[model samples]
Target: MAEPHPVLITPEWDAPATVRALCTTRHGGVSTGPWGEFNLALHVEDDSAAVAQNRKSLLKACDGLEQIQWLNQTHSPRCITADGNSLPEADAAETDHAALACAVLTADCLPVLFCDETGSQVAAAHAGWRGLLDGVLVNTVKQFRAEPETLHAWLGPCIRQPRFEVGAEVRVAFVERFVGPSRAEIENCFSAAGEPGKFLCDLATLAALQLRALGLSRVSDCGLCTVDDPRFYSYRQHNPCGRFASLIYRLP
Candidate 1:
């Protein structure tokens, strides 16, 4: 077994054997400034060497670095399958290979890990409000060949509803896409911000709703609030912040 790094572990329905999943906390790398200690994002202003070292550290924590598939996230609803040969430029990655891993990076956006209890497949997604509104979760499950009931999901760390304030336009966008009690559900996800047209939104609950809409009955979330938790790197709290990652893979 690999030694535990100072990170957050999120276990889905399959705990010990079928698969493993985790989201890194900004607690154990060589980054500085707003990026702080454990920034894994390449696009951030942190030194490339530091980012590389952080990645290496993460790989070590996860046991090995053979086939981890990292995506270039754009906050779109695009999801893809990856192998060791090539990388995909999308928000989510799913795979059935034991050696291959699927990963998603985020600061405040929701990072979702999906897998079957039987260890048949696994997927990871980065779902910002934009992606959620545009059907990213729905698209991700659609890409999964596994039956919905057989799938288990885990929501990693993200901005909490209390700290994630948004404008009315953002609420309207989600309202337009969501139906039924979804209006209330969507409204309930938001708390009243001091401003007239603004509200505090809950990314986790929104993601859970999305997963449930996709027929995934088994969903669990870490409930770790990025913006509120100092251990996490939050873009909303710090304007220029680093990104942590949520990764999933079947054991080889």
Candidate 2:
């Protein structure tokens, strides 16, 4: 028998007024096979019925099923402010609009949820390596219309440093984008992998650097490693695994 689905909540550092955030695990939904139970992604090969049930369960666990803006992530820096039922094809979603939740699906990519401390806005992003390298996080902060320093960031579960391998070209891309002595801080986020032309990348640290560069010092990470933790889905560890969801909503 499959285990019950698990739901992970962020700490107080991320709990802005009316902002409710949670990351669902693979344990609770109705998906079977490699996506066994609780796979919320409609793009996966799971039974449509199973995916529906998983989504239903997730909505019940997080908030009432009104309408959440689910993005069609393309690993790009694009972000859209959604107001209705239209599922926009973008990498991030945000709103000061009440009752409409913002969400993203992920296996190993970083799912970042954001809200201004003043409860004026909320947003979520699927920041995979490509998205991150291309400035998705920075673009996300801009969506709130506040100085990046006033926003709070909570990084959901993702593949950790020891398991996230990247090429030298990836590092070069980041170095070229970053400014000042902080260039070394970005480089230090990578470690020498045994393989040439490759290094171990730290997604969390990279995100922190980006947040710091934007002057946001209140970022807090959940510290859960998707690849290292079996309770969550991990694309790097299991290529065919189902994706879990990270959702955020503001109360009316």
Worst 10 residues of 1 by lDDT: 2-11
Off by over 4 Å in 2: 1-6, 12-14, 178-181
Worst 10 residues of 2 by lDDT: 3-12
Cα lDDT of model 1 by residue, 114-224, tens digit: 888687788999999998788778878887777887788999889888888899988888877753236778878878899898998987998898788678888988888
Q: Candidate 2 lDDT, tens digit per residue, 103-172?
A: 9999999998898888778889999988887878888887777887888888889999999999999888
Question: What Cα-based lDDT does every candidate model obtain?
Answer: 0.82, 0.82
Clash count per candidate: 0, 5
lDDT for position 91 in model 1: 90
TM-score of 1: 0.92
